[model samples]
Target chain A: MYEQLDQSIQQLMWDVRKRTLKRMQSAYDVAMKTSYKDLVTTVDKENERFIDDHLRKLDPNAKIVSEEGLGDKVTDLKGPVFIVDPIDGTMNFVMQHRNFAIMIAFFVDGQPVYGYIMDVIEGTLYHGGPGKGVYCNDQRLHAPADNDLHDSLVVLNSGITLNGGHNFREIGLQARGVRMYGSAGIEMIAVITGRVGGYLSYLHPWDLAAGMAMAKELGLSVKAIDEKELDVLSSNLVLVATQQVSRDISELIN
Target chain B: MYEQLDQSIQQLMWDVRKRTLKRMQSAYDVAMKTSYKDLVTTVDKENERFIDDHLRKLDPNAKIVSEEGLGDKVTDLKGPVFIVDPIDGTMNFVMQHRNFAIMIAFFVDGQPVYGYIMDVIEGTLYHGGPGKGVYCNDQRLHAPADNDLHDSLVVLNSGITLNGGHNFREIGLQARGVRMYGSAGIEMIAVITGRVGGYLSYLHPWDLAAGMAMAKELGLSVKAIDEKELDVLSSNLVLVATQQVSRDISELIN
Candidate 1:
């Protein structure tokens, strides 16, 4: 039954990816008129609507949470719940057009059962179920080799790092290097693929839900500030890292 | 004659973009035996060779300066020389396969005469010749509005921000926000397109050559640290910003 549900959700995600891509090509230019900081294009709204409608049809009983306000309101994340970010990295979607992604995760009783992150331009999906290992397209991904902080490149938010938010600078100083690729979904893909040992950012639930699902499946540590289990309903400073690297980073930052 | 020269260089740049794209797709999955920090993939060398060979045919007498050592020895910036970075943001190219770009610039008597930055996957080229308006794929771009620090977004390397390089914290505090996009070439494009007010990063010459040309032509300020004119062949903390935002950030950082 879980396998059947996973297959259906994957199909839904692919459809979402296609519809989002078409809308983005036409709507990106319109964002130029809006204030750059507050730039949200017509595509963002349309994509979220498209995804939400399809998701409701697929799982009528599930509560939906999303960034673009297309999903239902729910006080608690119990039973089957779907978290969707129709377009993660709206700035990149409106401005750069390539770094943005479509992210969706299915959680059961506060635990992610499935996650999907699609790089729309490349048509590549990084996805997996809890017991089924991660896959980048058709190829299965092995768990990343254990890596240490001094030997690891990390992804961090420049704003947070500069503001000394969540002790970001101490973590930055201990790592081999730091990279910031804007989109939380894409950065999470990097972490799952082992391109970066960890990713640290203050992000919304829709921004993290899908990627967090994949990270946990790939044997990486996923935690909120103070090293607690992630609260999937609010903004949190999330850390996704290898066990050793997470330990080193947490020690520095904490 | 200048028109013909510009067309020739643009054609060469397109070819480089195509070849690099193909090479990158095929080579990204190879395992690294060396340290990740020092890992230079086969594609980098091959892409540099392809670019160097084509540029040499276009300007046989011109010295070629390149990042990957596959070009002519360019100890002195003399005569009409071509500066090329076959793949800027090589780590992104290797790890993410999306954020990187191909950069090229022509310096005549050490003054930029032409520049090209190609988004390899998107096939969009930002190019211009001296006195010829800057363009992204045939559409002319207007100079960004004169923005102040409090109303502007600045792009800086996350590493630099964390280490307090150039007082990035102070600069971040003054600006509307700070973003780290991980690619100097891409960050320059952000500034050119008005998505970002400025980009500050410690950059090598190849990284900044093409970007500086575009920024300067579009009425943006491109300066070295301490408000000095940038020497074309040296590494420095380069600042590319709109005129007013540059002054505001410089005051904050200094």
Candidate 2:
């Protein structure tokens, strides 16, 4: 019975995400007529409102923390909360029309229970509930084998190295190679799919919530600074990696 | 009659590229069985030989300059020449299946007369001939409206700020934003489609050949350092952009 309910919710969320993507695409096509760098279009705001409304109707008791500032201001993660990032990679969506993802995470008393990351253009969904295993589209994902730092690839902001921001230069030297794809949601997908061993970046709650759920389900580590569980309300440098690689990288960075 | 011949050659080249993609995919899938980065397959030589053999029958007088060195070595581009990169973005192809492209260019008397950049995963082709308009799949591209640096989005390797390999740090500061997608072919697509105002990177001739052709046809400037036509045999920092944006960026970098 619980499985049926979860599937039903998944289907509803999937439909909502697809509709939101279409609307965003149309708005983006129109916005191309003007300057591309201007942030927060009407479509972005409208889409967030639509999702928030639908989620509210579905779970009236759920507290929402969203990027667009339409949700409650709860200081603590005390109850059922839906963390939403209406558009995780706004710049990528506004400019490239690819590499952007819609991220949503459901947390119970500050612990994640379910997560979903959708690649809009490719129509791929990465989602899983606690202990239910992760899925990319319809297929199940097995945990990627344990790998070391030298044999692993990473996703990071290249500007970190250039600007001497947050010890990124040292991190770059430790990894075999680094890739910058410019979208947090897409970067999370790479980590879950084992294309890259880990992803580290400074991100907001909406950006990290769904990805944290998916990463945890894949047997990958999802932690805040110093290997602690993430604080859902504040921005921090997060790292998601295999246990061994995470240990190696954490020791180096910390 | 000439049009039919051109179409036939295009079809043959496209088929060859598709096969090459499949071979690489198989190698990657098998490698994933043991480890992700442990296998670096040597299909580059075989793929180049296969493509060169096929092109020879269609254009017997065409000189071939391929990455794997399977073709003739001509000192001067005196006649028809086929520039080929059997596997562009080899690292991405070896590590991740989604971000690579196959590039081919046809030059006549030392000038790019035709070119194709195929995104193998998505199966989209950006192709054009001299005197013909550029295309993505079958849709024609209009030259994007002129954009200024402050209003423009640019793509560059994120490491530019850290490695100081090229003058990327200064350019990154000047643009509205910077994106790094990890493949020269895909990055070129961002510019051709007007999602980005420009792309700058140190690239080899085979890597830039097809992209240069498509960029030029789309009314974007394709220039080597010092603002000269690119020599088709050397590695250099190449820039592709709208004429106005390119000029603005050149001044900033200089």
Candidate 3:
């Protein structure tokens, strides 16, 4: 039902990647929205404007949900909802100028239709949805092996293992090794591409929307921490993992 | 005195990157050396052999110290010494097939003459040493700005912050963020590129040698924790950072 739209959005993402990278090279200002951890940049806003405008041109009727407040309030996913995260790893963007991503996911009545995660620096776009099979650029990406925690590495952020009361430390020890790259979109790429077994972090709707869509298409699982129903309109303590690793995480936690 | 030698080694590193990445695409056997965390693959042995032979041809009198035990067992760095970490993130290699590196460093009479770190997946060769400027893929890489903990991100492993008592958690909270990518070579690349402020980990001679060489050239500090003098023959708890941030780490620890 969405093949033509998928090709259009993928082309749009390539255009977004090129223009955003050019802006990064030319000039951009960095500023903190809440704290040093939460950063926003002029490039981010400009990119959001660029993407939102293009998305509007593509699907003007879609209700948009964006990270930088350039789109709609998006109270409900009642219709075609467009979720945009212009630069997903804002701190990495502000600090390292790499490891960030441009993400946009299209949903219809809360069901993900076509999701896009463009690794801006590498120029590899991970895009697809239900019935579409995932693609890392032009190649057909394979689903990860159904390996459990013992044989696979996991992606983590320190807050879950250090600040919160979770068994992430134990999980890290059991799961071959632990890797922490501070980008939700990039880390999700890790999971979607089968590079890591799973990823656990507190992620916003915009941050996980595209990743969740791609992961699901690749036969992986995405869920909230407590196994509660995930609310697409709100922040979620998210876990995206291979099916076996998902059970392994629960087994260890329990 | 060694301009010609530098270009030659850099070219050799680029070749090593190509061969290693090609080997990764083919069949390889993964085995546990000490634990699941310490992995060695057939490709690691092959890459070491490839690099050792090239180094021998480049400088016949040099001694080699290799990770997979494919090189010499010399006691001290009395003459030209070539250190090789065939696959520096073997776990990442065995699992993810990326985030690994092929590292080789040349030292003359215990002084770093040249260093090479090739990020195999990305195909970026970061190489240089004393009297030579660092280059990231032919671009003159600039030394990172001297920034303190609060304004910068830090790299860490779980053992330090979660298992050992090093004030790393407090230090992480104070810093911009803490990143842990699991590969010593890749993490060191992050430090050399100024992507992150510092990296702290327990490192072996082969793991630290190439990074130590290039890092020193870029004006970053490489030190043993507790201000102990590092022994090139043994493993040490290493810290690589900007000078002021090195002081900041000491302050937080004390």
Indicate which candidate wins on TM-score: 3
Candidate 3: deviation at residue A252, Å?
Answer: 2.5
Please list the residue runs of candidate 2 whose C-alpha ends up more than 4 Å from where it truly belongs after superposition: A1-5, A24-38, A226-229, B28-40, B158-161
TM-score of each: 0.84, 0.91, 0.97
TM-score of chain A of each: 0.93, 0.90, 0.97
DockQ value of candidate 3: 0.73
> What is residue A237's positional error in candidate 1, in angstroms?
2.7
lDDT of 3 by residue, B106-133 (tens): 8889888888889988888888887788
Q: What ranking emerges by TM-score with the best candidate at the front?
A: 3, 2, 1
The lDDT leader among the candidates is: 3
Please report, in order, the local distance difference test score of every candidate based on alpha carbons.
0.80, 0.75, 0.86
Q: Measured by TM-score, how close is model 3 to the native structure?
A: 0.97
Error of 3 at B22 (Å): 2.6
Query: What local lDDT does model 3 show for residue A146?
Result: 86
Which has the greatest DockQ? 3
Rank the candidate models, highest lDDT first. Answer: 3, 1, 2
Question: Per-residue lDDT of A1-254 in model 2, one digit per residue for the tens?
Answer: 23653575577567767777667545343243234443665656776887788778778998999887898896888988988877777777766677788778888888888888888788888888678789887899888767777777787664554566766656665665677777789999998888888788888898888888878888898888566667968887888888877887787774
**RMSD over all Cα atoms, model 2:** 3.6
